[model samples]
Target: MNWRLVFVLFAVFAVGTNALIMAGIVPAIATGLNTSEAIAGLGLTVFALTYAVVGPTLPIILSRFGRRTIMAGGLILFIGGTVLSGLAPDVSIFMLSRVIVGVAAAAIPPQAAAIAIAISPPGREGRALGLLSAGILLSIALGVPLGSLLGIWLGYSGAFLFLASLGIVGLIGLFFIPPTPKPAKATIAEQFAPFRRPAVLVLGLCAFLFAWCQYSITTFFAPLVKDSAGISDVEVPILLVIYGLTGVVAALFGGRLIDRFSGYAVAIGGFIAITITTPLFSVASSFLIAAIVVVVWSLAQNVTFPAAQVEMGRLHPANPATAFALFAALVQAGGAIGAAVSAGVLEALGPRWIAPVAAVATLIGTIVISLLARRLRRQNEAQSILVEATVDEAS
Candidate 1:
């Protein structure tokens, strides 16, 4: 195992925790800031929007400095943002801090994805990528629950402080990473050119739709559980721990499934899981039922990401950074929209409506993903045939 790669994965874990910890503790943050859940949810929306817009741009502007600098810089910015959020006196300032953290959070994933793809030995890219995805799930499992607990004990500001401390550890880990060669700089046109491919665009669209659906549930999960099961805020952390632990298992194993099966098959399986589980989340009446549903929902969600990342990475092997950046951008765009729209849903229709709406969206995403898989299959066959023809002609 490459320790450097492991460090990169840990950095991703820390970044993901910083970005997603809010989802688990939004209500606490809301009450602390003397705001409504809707407004607090906007913190999620703003963070995701900043990530969607700024993530891809960071690689371009910071390319001259190289990935190492970008990674270190992102952590420093994240620490600063977390400090600001901890000290924020108003909802507006808190939201602004989230935007800063989101922008900083954006820088890590593409760099991590690029590094993961670059360092993985042949035939293990899926497994390597799976490890990276697992970092995110681990955050959900470990970071979110802990953060939620911290919020209950010390308030949301304390949770922010805890997250900032984690960032410090991740920054220190960076020193052990050996110096890496700078990647060839890609032009803006080259970065965006992959969208011209029908398959790539279709995959990106599927990612967008699924992400919207996934985040719809994630952003309001604790609140929804409280409404459904009459749980106190203190209990949210424990349930989320259940949610995260199950997801961690799924993430660790999901990569092997992706490696053994086709990305298309793995993705379709995940889509089916989400389509089925998301609606169930809406109607689950008891805590036990919801916990079961959350486990399955998290499994599907955890597995789906590595499959999608692997596919996108394969799609543009020459420029993994740009390719994964576009993928992340679309996913974050979907998440931003999901957060914004779910707030309206929570206010008007109630939290019970969120999963059903997400199920509807996931159904559409599944259809598009099927088409993308078929397209890739056909493209692969054509390329194989061309290779065979050239070999025969030479013979």
Candidate 2:
């Protein structure tokens, strides 16, 4: 492993932990802010919406700077926003703080991925990307559960402070990393040129759909488990730990599988597994059954993300940064929409409906990926036939 990638992974872990920790402590935040959990959930929506809107543009706007400079700047902003979140007097101020953190977070993951790809040893790009994914998974496995415990013990404000401390650690670690080369300046249109491809469009849509499905449940995971299994607040973190640990295993090994098989194969399998297991949430009558379902669901969800990222790199090798930025933005947008939609569902129909709705989205995403795979296969076959005919004629 390149030591630099380790720092990149650490940076991602810090940022991702902040991004995901809210899901685990929504009730705490609601109680602290004197707002409804549904309103408190809007914090995620605001953050994700800001991230989706700002992420792709930030890289293009700052294309002149080295990757390290941009990432370090982001971490600085993250720390400030995290502290502000901890001090906010009301839900409105807390949400505004989230927007700041979202913009800050927008700077990290895509650049981290570009750095990983640039620095990784040959044929190990998948593993390298997997490591990046693991950073986020490990954040879930470790950070969220810990944050929830802190929220329980200290308050949601304390949880935010804990995350801010992590941000400071990530910022200091950034200085140790060797600076990455500056990207060439490109016009906005040129930067977005990859969107012209049909495959890129299809893949982006698939990313959105799957993310929509996944976040609908994940944004309210603690509440969902509580409602279904009658688990206490403290036990919610245990389930999250279980879910995230399984995700870490899947992400680390799923990269090797991507290298061995194709990204398309792995991604399709993941989507299918999710579609199957997601609806099972409706029937999870006991904590044990919910835990079992969570393991399968997390494995499917985690593997799908990295595989899609691998495909994004392959699909737009000429400018993977743009592809990654766009993918990240769409995923955030999907998450925002999903969270908002699920909040409405939770308010209207209740928690049980969330899984069925999410499953439908996953099923649609599965069909989208399958279609793209078939198209790519035919294109490869046609090119192979053309090469064979040219050789025969020459002979």
Backbone clash count for every predicted candidate, in the order shown: 0, 0
lDDT of 1 by residue, 117-183 (tens): 6666767777778788878878877876666678788788888888788788778877876565575
Candidate 1 least-lDDT 10 residues: 177-186
Clashing pairs in 2: none
lDDT of 1 at 14: 72
Give the number of the best model, judged by lDDT: 2
Query: RMSD per prediction, one decimal?
Result: 3.2, 3.1
Clashing pairs in 1: none
TM-scores for all candidates?
0.86, 0.87
Per-residue lDDT of model 2, residues 70-177, tens digit only: 788888899899999888999889999999999988988887887788777767788888888988989978876676678888788888888888778777877777
